[model samples]
Target: MIVIVDYGLGNLGSIKNMLRKIGYSSMVSSNPDEISKASKLILPGVGAFDTGMRHLTDSGLLDILGYKALAEKIPVLGICLGAQLMTRSSEEGCLSGLGWFEAETLKFQFDGIAGKWPLPNIGWRDVFDVNGSPLLSGFNSTPRFYFVHSYFLKPLEQDIVSMNVSYGFEYACGLSKGNLHCVQFHPEKSHKFGMQLLRNFSELT
Candidate 1:
């Protein structure tokens, strides 16, 4: 069964509800054993970088999840701040991340167009596939997903980027490498396209 990690840093109920709507059986728990036994895992987060990491560390899930997702190669999906936690570090906080990916989370810099758009880019934005990821499969065209973040991941390896979203500038929003998958957008809130993406993830081995 898919396990939605409850580290006190995410919208656990909403994610579980979304999974239910998609007809997927999932459990939300902070129990290490339950997490270790998961066929698939969803790491959901909605908060600051340091706070999320602290919660995960305190939840006693760090090592088990590391083994499952990294060593054992179990399929894992990280949403929003969860995705950022998969990286090495973040500009939002000084804490080191899970370091699963050789990437860094950076605050949005509007550069010359600073006043043109708002920070923490909220609302819907279209994401374009970069490498035709299985998670993005079955889509006839680019799909727009809900985004509400001030920072984005910058993976060192360009090949790992599954999709990108253009704000004031283009940034990597979807990352896939081996059994690990991460999306900056909230598929759980993105309507049909989001549901399709979640469905695709549920089907992954």
Candidate 2:
């Protein structure tokens, strides 16, 4: 069963409901045993980076998650704030992420460029699948997904990065390497397109 980590920092109910709608009923758990035995790990979040990280650590879920990803190498997925935590670190509140993916999170700069676009990048935006992983099967190379954040992440290396989405400038939108996959968009909130992506991940090899 898929285990949704609940650190009191994510849109947990909406994600759970979305999964049920897609016919993938998951067990939202913070128990150590449940997480270790989980078929898939979904690290979802919807809050400040530092606050989320603190909650994870205080709850003892962070270490368990790290062990699962780094040692067991279980197929894992991260969304938005969760995806940002997958990177080495983030600039938001000087946050230290889970450091699973080889990327770094940075705040918006490009003043001239961002002036033309919106901050927090809320609502629907299309994503260009650069690596074409099966986790996004049945989804187009450029499909609309939901996003809401101020910072953006770039893969430390291009080889490990896959998709890119444009805001003020194009940045890594999805990241995948081996058994680890991360997306910046919220599939649970992306409607049909998002549903397909979540379904793809549920049955991905």
Using all chains and alpha carbons, the TM-scores for the candidates as numbered come to 0.97, 0.94
Worst 10 residues of 2 by lDDT: 110-119
Q: Which regions of candidate 1 fall more than 4 Å away from where they truly are?
A: none
lDDT for each of the candidates? 0.92, 0.84
In the range 178-205, model 1's lDDT, one tens digit per residue, is 9999999999899889888999999999
After the best TM-score superposition of candidate 1, give how far the Cα of residue 12 lies from its true spot, in angstroms.
Answer: 1.3
Which one wins on TM-score? 1
135 in model 2: Cα distance from truth in Å? 2.4
Report the Cα lDDT for residue 103, model 2: 91
Q: RMSD for each model, in Å, please?
A: 1.1, 1.6
Top lDDT hit? 1
Clashes of 1: 0
